[model samples]
Target: MGALEGRVAVVTGGTKGLGLKITEAFVAEGARVVVGARGGAGADGALAHLDGRAVFRQTDVRDPASVRALMEAAADRFGGVDVLMANAGLSRPGPAAGLAGADWAQVVDTNLNGLFHCVQAAVPYLERSGNGRIVTMSSALGSRPAPGASAYCATKAAVEMFSKVIALELAPKGIVVNCLAPGFVDEGMGRLLKQNQAVWSTYAPKVALGRMGTGREIAEAAVYLAGDAGAYVNGHVLEVNGGLAW
Candidate 1:
């Protein structure tokens, strides 16, 4: 039997990129997943192979009501929520000196506030699950400084601290909150960065592994955190960066 057999998971921004990989991994582990994203469920048959193990809900995590409905939909469909993967986030790259206020707000709203909304909305159901797990996404840049990524770095740093704080507050309620901090991955935003050879050349050597991390690698870390293996782990920020020196 799979490690997460019989569990129900809610994954935000699960329609594409790294989030999609995590969603697929959860289903493979025998969990029913409710995917929430602001956009449509990606290129038509993206999730068809899951064979009905996953369902999609149009969700805007920045909106409290939308996030609430997402959690409720998961409970209504899968019976109860055992895990929450708060993975919806975005980055607006620009130097702090010239960054637009609107861009900053957009990043903060989606990355920080949106995560808070999902956590708050899912807490009631998570509390009832008996063994609730929360895995919040962060980035290596959360702790390491990066030029022109002020918004992303700041929000991710906040996410790490926020996860730690909630871990303490919710531990007594049987809910474990942890953070997943990934380094330069080979997909999503990381892929975009690699497209610029000039930029990639400069940052590639920072990874001791000499390569970007894979989505599956990150997903496996998440599974460990959310499954029985992580029952005793809490209030921790698990960095999945391949030994990034920077």
Candidate 2:
């Protein structure tokens, strides 16, 4: 049997990129997946080829009602959520000096506050599972820094801390919370590097693996976290950086 057979999972932003890869990982192992995004906004709609294995729910995570509905959907369809992967995020260029107030607010609200709303919404369903896992995504930029990426970096760092705190609060109830911090993940987001190679070239020598990471590569770790293998692991920030000194 697949590792996740009969389990139920909710992957936010599951319609594309890392979220899509994570969804595929879970489904391959036989979990019933509920994918929620702004609905059909990701790659290939991020829903191609997984017809019977997953269901899609339109979710604007920043809204509490939308998030609650997405979480409740898993129970409605398959009887509760076993895992919640808070993976929806946005990154836009806004210089620290000239970044508009709204841009900062939008970024933080979506990445940080939105994650809180998702966890609160899913807590009840997760608790029902008797054993639940919450995996959130972060970036090396949070520990390091990029000149024009203030908002993204700040949110990621906060996400790491958030997961740690949540893990502590939920541990007694058998829920484990963790963060995955990737280095330079190229889930086609690397397309930007073609014209802007100089922007990230300095990171080349330090990337010990000598290349960028992919969505599937990152998902492997999520699969581990969602499995029993991670039972004793809680409040951890597992960095998936390829020995990259970012």
Candidate 3:
């Protein structure tokens, strides 16, 4: 039996990167998992690897109706939701000064508004669990400003505060809300790092560990906060950045 034994969880954007890693970790910890993605996680049978341990649902977190449908499916299939990894949204666009008007809006709408929709939709089912937990994906960018990454930073900053408010409001109901922020996952951020090896190389030493972190490492952090160990750890913003910012 795993730490999340018998619980049902929803991991958004679980097709790849940190989201997929987190979903895999939850399943390994004995949870029934449901993954969400914009158009499924894989392009060519990438999802088949999970076998039946997980299932993918087409979701657009930015759309309220789509989010509601997603929650309905989870409730009907898994009976109710115990843990919700509100990990949807994108990490694109660009610097505050460089991004087009539409690009900025897109980033904010998905990263901020979209995440809000997931939590709002899952409230009813989470309440049914009688001990709900919402672990949202934030970023090291959320903690301190990283140059050329304003959109991502803004949304994440909002994510931390929003989850805190949620924690305060839902504490009376036995629901925990927290933020999971990673500096850069070795797997998913490959493109960003590769695009700017100079940047990564320069900052490598700052990580203290002298390297980037793996998806599993970030997933482990999510698991800690999602399970019973973090029951009392509410409204907190966890930094899994290899001590990069501290």
Supply candidate 1's per-residue lDDT for 246. 75
Residue 160 CA displacement from its true place in model 3, Å: 0.5
Give a tens-digit lDDT track for model 1, residues 168-235.
99999999999999998888999998888899999999889999999999999999998999999999
lDDT of 3 by residue, 1-246 (tens): 798998899888887877888888998998888877787535226556666767778889989999888888877788889999998867665767778888788889898999899999988888889979999888888878877778888999999999999999988877899999887668776447846978777777778777778889989999999999998899999998777843
Please provide TM-scores, in order, for all candidate models, with all chains considered together: 0.98, 0.95, 0.94
Give the candidate order by descending TM-score. 1, 2, 3
Q: For each candidate, what is the lDDT? A: 0.93, 0.86, 0.84
Q: At residue 31, give the lDDT of candidate 3.
A: 86
Q: How close is candidate 3 to the true structure, as a TM-score?
A: 0.94
Candidate 2: minimum summed lDDT over ten consecutive residues — where? Answer: 187-196
